[model samples]
Target chain A: MNEEIVRLEDAWVHFDGVSVLEEVDLSINQYDFLGIIGPNGGGKTTLLKVILGLLKPSRGKVTVFGHTPEKGRKFVGYVPQYSLFDRDFPVSIWDVVLMGRLEHKKRFKRFSEEDKKLAYDALETVEMLDFKDAQIGKLSGGQQQRVFIARALVAEPKLLLLDEPMASVDSPMQTELYELFEKLRQRMAIVLVSHDISAVSIYVDKIACLNRRLFYHDSKELTAEDLEATYQCPVEIIAHGVPHRVLKEHK
Target chain B: MIEILQYEFMRNALIAALLASIACGIIGVYVVVKRIVFISGGIAHAAFGGIGLGYFLGVNPVLGVIPFSIAAALSMGIIGRRTKIPEDTAIGILWVMGMALGVIFVALSPGYAPELFGYLFGSILTVPTSDIILMLSLNAAIIAVVFSLHREFQAISFDEEYATTIGLPTERLYLLLLCLIALTVVLLIRVVGVILVIALLTIPAAISRQFTHRLSSMMFLSVFLCAILTICGLWLSYAFDLPSGATIVLVSGTAFILSTVSKSIHISVFSKSI
Candidate 1:
């Protein structure tokens, strides 16, 4: 059996007495590419935060690599939603990517040669080695997203979590990013939250449709009932030849 | 002009200026890059309350400001984080309340404090040897803390959520940064006065940012530029018989305008040619 990299048992999260996630039992394996699909403000980010140890679940247990989230998080790489940062912040691609090695260095210590090699290797994995010297803001949206991925990857984590990775990328670049993730999931467990259901269904090994509660299936195939269960309305799930899941107007 | 260095007071003022510049240059980059100019201003003004309390209590105002400003910085950090009060509103309240407290304390101090104006609008010439030593110690502490936590600071400043997700103790680091800013405020209050501290803290870093994309380079350039500004302003003030602190800030202000305007012009010209 593949090892469980992350396990959340009966997890519940609440903000200001309003429940965001309830009884979300999830288990991610060593090679799982799990796509989490949900509406805006539907506890997706809260779940991600819980898994990353940034927020504690109100109840239940969350263990990563058989340890508490805090201790286990060092082996996890995170690519947050891209809108929270100052785009014009004065940092080069090299500097931004090297930030991933923060946990590995001692106080007042310079980056080790091994750290440098890992950073460059991560950048190369994202095919961004050539632009390592460029300012981050100077890159296109797709390119900046790739740099963020490189930053996350530089730590060589066992699990990878990304929130809205395609939010700013152009439509054409979205497939390329998925392909990159496809390549990455071969080495580590990948969990991504995205609104792009069609591409997610095609590329991910499993899909978790979440609202306040979770309706998880361990395969890309989903019934119309799963769509309605998550969206809270009657909806159609149309599968095209491109391996996409298109939603029809509510009846 | 060279003979100015021969005077004891002149020598103290020069050394004071160098120490103050070191504090501003190092912490000022964080201030500018993090876009916390107003927050730093709020901390500086709130520090005036400590000065006033010191005078009211018959002790050193600098001593009073140390704890007072740290308290203010911490409360500001807490209020900004835990409450629904808009950060700008909270800063404004703290800024004015701090000054109001200072005024009340000074009014209650029972004597005419003539040197109060020197605290508001600094006179570098009046900085004594003891205060210079205090500033030097503060500079050393700032360098030490920043050196040890440079990566954490950079991470939090750039992407705090990402930093937290990676299990970095971001909240504690942020509060520590505020404390450092508090100390930096103390170092600058004697050089630029409470009224002009933010200008000294921000202008040189802003200028250095135009030439460097890295934080370390920005700090080094800011340190150099601040030294130049302080020395030239001191000379000009001596030559014209003007206020040294205000003159130094004005010089920096003028340079800020020139750098910003020239940058815009360069960008436009390059785009037009492109």
Candidate 2:
């Protein structure tokens, strides 16, 4: 079996005693492409934070690469949900991508030639090398998303956690991005989180639904019960390509 | 103008302004980009408490500011992050409280407070050589810290959650930035006074933001702009017999308005040409 990249055993999180993530269990293996879809405010970000060890779980065990989340997070690349909160923050695309190399960089030392080479490769992979010196905010929303993906890829991480990468991107770039993710999953595990269930369902190998509680299936298909329980309401899911139903109308 | 250099007080004032520029240029970029102008202002005013403590204790008020402002920075940083109170509310509370404490401390002192007006309105001409030495060292320390941690600072200022995912200690880095602001308040207390420190801390960086896409270059431009403006303000004050602090802030504020206006005009013209 491939290396276990992430494992959660009944993890729970509460902010001010309001349960955000309730008793969740999940696992991901190397090179696994998992998609998590849910409504907004449904603990998606909180779960990502828990895995990154930015927030501690109130109860239960969560580990990445078998190490505690804090120590293990160095091997993860995170593309945050917000494209760039402060677009006019005066950072160039090159600077944004190079931030991925910061974990490998030592104090009082400059980014090595190899680090720069990796960033160069990452930008090239995303076809954004031409705009390396452009200010990050000046780009269109699709271009910004690609640059963020490049930033995440620069670190050569074992696991890439993309929170809503398609949230702001238009449909055409969405296909291009998903195709890129397919190529990327050959080397590393990719976990794509979003509210658009059909888009995530099309490209990923496995699917999970998360509200306060997480309903995960080891395979790609999700049962109707899973959809209703996760959304807490009836769901009608129409996929992007050829006519398909993620959730058929329940009797 | 060149003849004024021969006067020791004038020379000292220029030196103080130059020293103040270093802090303003480097830390000011973060202040502007992070939108923490009010927090820096809060730190500046809360420093009045320390000035009062110095008066009550009969020591150098600048020395009193060092500890008092650091304490205030840490308190505000902690409470604002950890508690339920909105950050601006926290700042507003501490801002007036510091001034109130300073007022009471001065009122309770044994004799009439003579240097009080200078602390409030700035008296750059009267800055002791001792204060210059202090500003020089403080400038050195601020530079060293910024040089070492600039990468982390850039990361947090850009995207704090991502910085934390990479294990850069974002909270500590943020608090350290505030502490740097506190130290800067000390440096500027002798230049612009507490009330006007925000002007020097923000205007130069805001103007520099218009011209640069890189953080390092932004700092360089901001420092240059601030030094020139403060000197121009100093000269105007010296020639016209005006208040130095208000003059300095007005000079920078005018430049900020001009740069912003020019930028808008340039954009509109460029779009039309295109």
Top-DockQ candidate index: 2
lDDT (0-100) at residue B88 of candidate 2?
87
The alpha-carbon lDDT assigned to residue B84 of candidate 2 equals: 100
lDDT of 2 at B75: 86
Error of 1 at B182 (Å): 1.3
How big is the positional error of residue B150 in model 1, measured in Å on the Cα after superposition? 1.3
Write model 1 residue lDDT over A67-134, tens digit each, in one string.
Answer: 99989999899998878789878789999999998878775788899989999999999999999999
Instruction: Return the lDDT, model 2, position A16.
Output: 94
Residue A11 in candidate 1, Cα distance off native in Å: 2.7
Off by over 4 Å in 1: A238-240, A243-251, B82-90
Query: Please, what are the lDDT tens digits per residue for candidate 1 over residues B1-274?
Result: 7788899999999999999999999999999998889999999999999999999999979999999999999888889987989888888999999999999999999889888998898879988899998998999999999988888899898988888877677888888998999999999888889999999899999999998888899999999999989888888899999998899999999999999999999999999998
Give the per-residue lDDT of model 2 (tens digit) for A3-81. 8889999999999999999999999999999999888899998899999999999999999988999999887888888
Off by over 4 Å in 2: A239-251
Poorest stretch of ten by lDDT in candidate 2 chain A:
A240-249
RMSD of each: 2.6, 1.9
